[model samples]
Target chain A: MTTDGSWRHTAPERGDAVTISVDGEPVRACTGETVAAAMLAAGAAFERDRSGAPRAPLCNMGTCFECAATVDGRLLTRTCLIPAREGMVIKTPGRL
Target chain B: MFDLAIIGAGPAGMSAALTAADHGLTVVVIDEQQRAGGQIFRQPPETFAGSVLHPTAGYGWATELIRRFEADPRLTTEFGWSAIGVLHDDAEPDGLCVAINHPEHGTRMIGARRLLIATGAYDLPVAFPGWTLPGVMTAGGVQTLVKAQKIAPVGDVVLAGAHPLLLLVADLLIRDGVPVREVAFAQSIPTPVDMLRALGAVPGHLRMLTETGAILARLVRKRVRVSSRTIVTAARGTEHVSRIELARVDRRWKVTGAPREVAASHLVLGYGFSASTELARQIGCELVFDSPRGGWVVAHDERLQTSVPGVFVAGEPTGVAGADQSRAEGTLAGLGIAASLGRAVPAAAFAEAERGIHASTRFSAVVQSIFEPVRGALGDLATRETTVCRCELVTRGELDDFLESSPFVSNVNAVKLSCRTGMGPCQGRYCENSVGAILASAREQTIGLGGRFSAHLPIKPVPVGDLRDLDAVTEQPASDGSDTGRSAS
Candidate 1:
C-alpha cells in the first residue's frame, strides 16, 4: 500500500496537526487539509465498494463522488470537500 | 433571498459572483471547495493560505479576484457546499430555488431572485483496462491534489491521454520535483504546418502560444518528452497502479502497434472534459448537443437565459470552453442577470463582454479542434473485461451481456436501470459517456443525449440526514443578511 508519506507538499509545514480518528483509530492530520488528503497521507483507503474492493479518492474534486465517506456520522459525506476539524471522526466502509 | 445564487465558485462562478456583486447585487456563491479559485486556479486549504503557491498560470488574476471577492461584504461565499438539485416553481418568485448541502449545515434550500448555473466541468473519465485501479486517476485530478491539498504523487507517474493539459501538468509536477515516468499522447505530435494553422486559429492569443511553448521547452529540458501517438491500453496492479501497457495509435487514434508494458506506480489521464449539465438539465433547461466541446449543453437565448426564463447558465454548462471564455461568459451572464432583474446595465458594458466572449470563443474552438476530436474507436479500447462503470464496478462483459439480452435497448438510461451501470453514488459522472459510447458501438449508432442517462435529482447522492431534518432547519441568516439560500418548494 502507498503510505501517507508517499504524497507530500512542496510547501514547508508551519501549522500544528489536528487529531481525527480514521475508522475508529486516531490519526493526526494537518488542519485545513481534507479528510481524503489525510487518508492519502495515512495510506488509508476512503472506503470499500459493495464488492469489498478498497476505493480511494479518484476525482479529488467533488464530481466523481468516489471519495464519499462517513464523517461525524453523516452518511456518505464527501471527505474531499469536508475540511478536517479537530476531534472529527471519519468512518470508511471497513477494509476487507 | 439573494439577488443571485451561483452554483460553482470556479473561474466562471467567481467571475459571475464578482460581476453581479459589482452591479450591487447581493450575491451568494456556493462551491464544494474551501476557496474561490476553481480547478484552474485551485488553492490549497486555508492553512496554507500563507504559503506561496506554485504559480503555473492565472495566478495573478486568481489572487486579485479572490482578494476582492473575500473583501466584499455583500457577497456570501458558501464553501464546502454541494448543490443537490434545483426546484423551479412557476407559481413562486424563487427564480428556480437551489437546494444545497454541507457537512456542517446539513441540507438547506436557498431561494435566489436570479440563478446562474456556473457549475464547471470535470475531467472526462476514459475507461480502459485496469483504469479503475486505485492509483489510476484523472491527470487534472492529480493536479488538484497536488495544487490544493499539497499532496504530490509518489514514484513513477505515467500520464496518459491526448490533451494539452497533460503537457502542462507534466511541466507543473516536474517543476515541483515530482518524477514523471512518461507522458503518453494518444494523438500524433503536431507538425510545423499544424502548429502554424493552430496559431492562425487563435488570432488574438499570442501569449497563450508562448506560454505553451515555454511549457514544452521545460519538459524537453527535464528529459520528459511526450511519447506521441501513444495510448495507454491498460493499467495492471493488485492494490495500486504497478504497470501500464502502451501502444502506438494512428492519426485517427486507431491502435496500430504491439502493446508494451512499463513499470508505473501511478497513471494520470487527461482525455479532455465533459459538460457538467446536471444542474442545468435539472432546471428543465433545453439542451443541445455540442460534440466537439461540452456534450448536451444547455440551450440559452441572447441574454444567456435558458429556456426557463430568469435562469442563466455560464461556463461549462453552456459548453466546455476554457477559463477565458468562461470568465467572459460570466460577465455577459452577470450583465444579463442584472438587466433581467430590472437593473440598468449600460449597453457599452454588454458590448465589451460580447467582444470578450467572441475572442475567447475563437480561441476555445481552435484549441478544442486540436485535442477534442480524433478519438476514433477509442471507446473500442474497453475489452470484455474492462470496468466501464467505476462506482458500480460493472464490467464491459456484464454491460455487453445485458445489452445482448435486452436487444432492443434504445438508450443508455435503459442500460443504466436494467444493468445497474449508472446507479452508483456518483450518478454516472465518471461512466455515463463511456457507457453511452460502448452502447452506441454495440447498437452501431451514434451516441446522442437520448443514448445517455437522463439526469435525476438529487444530482449526486444526498445523505438521508440532509433529507430528514429540512423542516426543522429554518431560514438561516446567510452572511449577516436576510439573504437565505433555501428556496420555498
Candidate 2:
C-alpha cells in the first residue's frame, strides 16, 4: 500500500520480520515483536472494526485491552503481547 | 506563629517549607506520615537493617530539602499531624486558619498570613476480584513494604498489572533479592502512531523504559521469567494468596479459552495512579478529570497554582510523573509562591525548574503508553458474591439491588446512603473506582461509551469529632463540584 509497509515510512531492517495479514493483505514483521509494533511499522493504525474508527495501541503491554485484533483465526488477541510468527494468518474480526 | 504554614509533608509540602525557610519565611511543615516523605518518597523506619539498599532514598529531593529546612532556624517541622480542615477567618485580613489533628497534642488551630497547600495526593482506589485478600495490595503498598518496612511480603510474588510504579516495585523486589515468580506485564494497549509523535516533550520516557528493562533483566537474572499479555483473573488463598489464575487476552483484552493456574504466596496488582487530592477536595477545591492521570485532580494552571488562590499542587497529585518531576514542580511552586509574595527569584531559577516539565512530558507519554485506567476491567469485579466494600463486608449484589430497588439510591450519594461502601474507614479509596467502572461498563452497553465517576470530599474519612471547634470552616453550596458536575452512577 505504501512503504512503512503502509505508505508512511520504509523500515531499514528485516531480521525481526515475520509474515501476517492485514484485512487479508499479507504483511511482514519481526520475530518476538508485538503485533502493535508490526502494525505501527507497517503504518497501520491497528483498528479492527469496520466502522473505520481510528484505534491505536494504548497501554502497550495489556491492561487497557485496547489493541485487540484477530490472530490466526483466533478472535481478539492482544497484538501487544503476541509474538510475530511466520505464516500466521490474521483476520479482521469485523469480517467474520 | 510561623510566617508560612505548609500543609501535607510530601515532596511538595516539604520542599515548600524548606525553600520558604531558606528565603527567610518562618515556616512550619506538617505531615500525616509518622516520618517525612510522601507515598512516592516513603522511607523505612530508622531502626530497620537489611542487606538491601534503595538506589535512591525516599523523597530523594525532598530529603535534601528537609535537611536544608532542618538547618534553617526559621523552620519548624511537625510530623504525624493531619490537617483536619482549613478555616478562612474573615475577621482577620490575609489570615487563614487550619485545624490540625496532632496524634498526641490533639487538635489545634494555627494562623498564618500566607498558606501554601502542598498537600500531596492519595491513590485512586480501584477494586478488583479478590482484591480484598490480605496478601493482595496496591503497588504503592508493596513499595512501602520493600522500601519503608524492609520486609518481604511473601516468598514468591506474582506481580501483575500495568503502570510504571508496578514495574518499579517489581524491580525493587528483585533488587531486594525477593523471588518474583512471574512478572506478568499485562499493561499493553494499542498504540497510535500519533501518540508517539508527541514524545519530544518528554525526556523521562526513556528512563522509565530503561528502569522497566532493568527490572525485567534483573528478574531474568534472578531466574524469574517474564509473562507479557497475561492477567491474574482470580487470586486463591485461605488466609493469604496461594494461587493465581492467569489468562491470555487478545487485542481487545478479552480472555481466551482456558486459563493457566500458578501457585504463589503473594499477588501484587497495580493498575496505575489516582490523584490523591482528598485534602484538596475537603477544602472545597474543584476537581478536573484528566484521563491520562487517573481520578480527579485539583484544577491548576501552568505554574501549579490551584483554583483557590495561595494553594498549589505539585507531584503525582498534579499528575503521575516520577520523582525528579515532583521535585522540580515542588521547587517551581515554591518559587512561584515566593514571587507572588513579592520576593524576587532570578528568571534563570524558574527556567532551571522548568527543565523537568519538559523532561517529564516524554516520560508521561511513555508511561501513559504503558498503563492507563483499565476501562472495563472493573466490571469483572461485579460477581454477586464479590465483596464491594471489604471494610464493611458489603457485596456487589447488595449494591446492585440498592441501585435498582431503592428510589433514593439514584446516584453515588444515594448509593452511599443505601450501602456503607464509601463509608468505611479507608473511605472509598478501595471501592469508588470499581463502583464507577461497574457503572461505566454497564452504561457502555447502551450508551456506546462508559460514563466516569466524579471525585468528592471529604475525600478521606475525617473523624466527625475532629471537625468541632475548627474556626476556619467555610461552606460551599450543595453542588456535586466534580468535573462532570454529576456522577454517572
Candidate 3:
C-alpha cells in the first residue's frame, strides 16, 4: 500500500504520530485522527465488498456506514466514529 | 425528568440550550456525533492537534455559541447519543420520553417536560444509474470528509448536482488541495437580472457573493471545467467510479443533448438537503410539504412549537433556511419554552429574535429560489434500472412495476411494504424523498402538502443487545400502573 502521504495535506500542526495496524500492516496515524482518516491518508481503502471490490469512505459522517471495518476483532465498527488510538488493530473486509 | 431536552447539537440546539439555560431552565442536549459543533461548524476531537478553521465567514458566531454552550453549568451535553424514538405518556401528560442509544450506555430513556428537535438535514438522494457504486457519494459527505476528518478522496474528483452547496464544496476541496476535475451544475448560474432582483431582498448577502466570487476565481485559476445546466446521468465503472456520464439539461432539468462521459475517480452528488423529520413525525408532529424548504418539514407555529404540545422543532427540522435562521428560531423557541415554563423572559428578546428570523428567512428565500432542485430533475435522471433505495437495493424499475401492479399503493409507506424500498439500515432517510416524488408523479398528483407515512420508533438502527437492556429496564414493574404503557410504542 502507498503510504507516501501524497493524499494528505500538511496541517498547521499535527498531533503525536502513532502506529496502528491496518490489515496487520503498520500505518502511522496522528492522535485524534479518525481511523477512516488515517486509512485514507495512508492510501488504504476502508472496506471491500463480497465481490472483493474496494470501497472508500463516503459521508465521513457516521450516517452512510460505508466506512465500517473490523477493529480489534470486533465486527462492523464505524471507523469514522472511532478515534485512532496507538496500536489499534484495523482489518479491512478483504483481509478477513 | 429534565425540564427541557434538545435533540441535535447543531447551532439551533446549542443556541436553544444556552438561551433556555440562561432563563433558569435545566436543559439536556443530545447529539449523535461525538462532539458539539454539528455539521456546519464541526470541530475536531480535542486530541486532534491541528486547528479546525471554519470554512465559511460565520465562525465567530458559531464559536461564541459553542463556547457558551460548553460553559453553561445548567446545560448537560450528551455526545454520541442517538435518539431512536419519542414516547408520550398520559400519566405525565405534558412530559415525553426520548429513547436514546449509546455505544457504552446501551439504551436508556430520558424524560423531559419539553422536547425540542433541531435535528438538521441530510443531502437529497438523487438516484441515477450507477449511483449505488462505491465511489459516488453525497456532496455533504465529501464536505464532512474534508472538514471533520481532514481527509479527501484521492484521485480525480468531480462534483455534479444542483444547489449552491456544490460551489461551496468545490471551494473546500480546492482549498484542501484536492484536484477537482470538473463541476457540473444541473441548473444554470442565476441570470444577471435574477441576481439583481434577489439582491433587493437580501442586501446583506454580501458574504455569500464574496465567497462565490472567490470560489469561481479559484476554479478559473486552477483550470477546473465548469458546466452549467448539466447533470450526471450515469456513472460507469467496474468496482468503483471510473467515469461519469453528463448531459445538458433545460430549465426543467430535462436532458437536451447527448450524454458525455468524463473520467473521474470520485463523483460527488448533491441536489440540496431534506429535513430530517423522522423523529418529529414519529412523535406526531404535523408536517407540510414545501419543496424549497427541503420537503416535508415539521409544521411549527411562530414559537417553533409543533402541533404536538410541548414538542418544538427548530433548525432544518422546521425548514432548510441555513444556520442563521436556525439560530434565530432556536432563540425564539428557547424564549417560548421558558415562557411556557413560567420563566420571565423579556418581551424585547422575542422581538429581537423575530427580527433576526425575518431577515434570515428573507435571505433564505432567495437562496431557495436559486438553488432548489429543478422540478422533475431526479425523475428525469432516474432510469428504469437505476437504484432508488440503496439500503434495500430497490430499483426504479421495481418501484414503477410495483406502482403499476399495486394500484392502491398511493402513499410512501405502502410502496415500502410492497417492494421493501426503505427496509434498510438508513430507515428510509435517504430514499424517502425520491420515492415520495416517484409515487406522486405516478399518481398524477402534485408533489406537495400531504402523503407521508408515519415514521416508526427506533428511527435509527439499534443493536439487539441495547434493545434487551431497554427491555430489562422496562420489564421492572412501574411503581404505579400509570407507567404500564411506557414500553416501546
Order of quality (DockQ): 1, 3, 2
Q: If you assessed candidate 2 against the hidden native complex, which CAPRI class would it receive?
A: incorrect
Give every candidate's TM-score on chain A.
0.84, 0.72, 0.86
Question: Considering only chain B, what TM-score does candidate 3 achieve?
Answer: 0.94
Comparing 1 and 2 by DockQ, which wins? Answer: 1
DockQ of 2: 0.01
Which is the leading candidate under TM-score? 1
Note the residue pairs that clash in candidate 1: A4-A41, B109-B486, B109-B487, B110-B485, B110-B486, B110-B487, B111-B485, B111-B486
Candidate 1, residues B92-200, lDDT tens digits: the string is 6555567787777767766678889888888878888887678888877888887777767777788989788888878778977888878998877787877877776
Query: What lDDT score is found at residue A95 in candidate 3?
Result: 25
For candidate 3, write residues A1-96 as lDDT tens digits: 322222563464557788999987899888878887787777766666544555666566666566777888766667877778889999886523
What DockQ values do the models have? 0.57, 0.01, 0.38
Q: Write the per-residue lDDT of candidate 3 for residues B23-134, one digit (tens) a residue.
A: 8777878888777877877786666564654747643578878877777656666687788888875457777778887654568777788999999888888878887676
RMSD of 2: 19.6
| Clashing residue pairs for model 3 | none
Worst 10 residues of 3 chain B by lDDT: B474-483
| Ten-residue stretch with the least lDDT total in model 2 chain B | B480-489
Model 1, A6-87: lDDT tens per residue?
5665666625688899888877687778888877777776687777665667888888877888788777777888778789
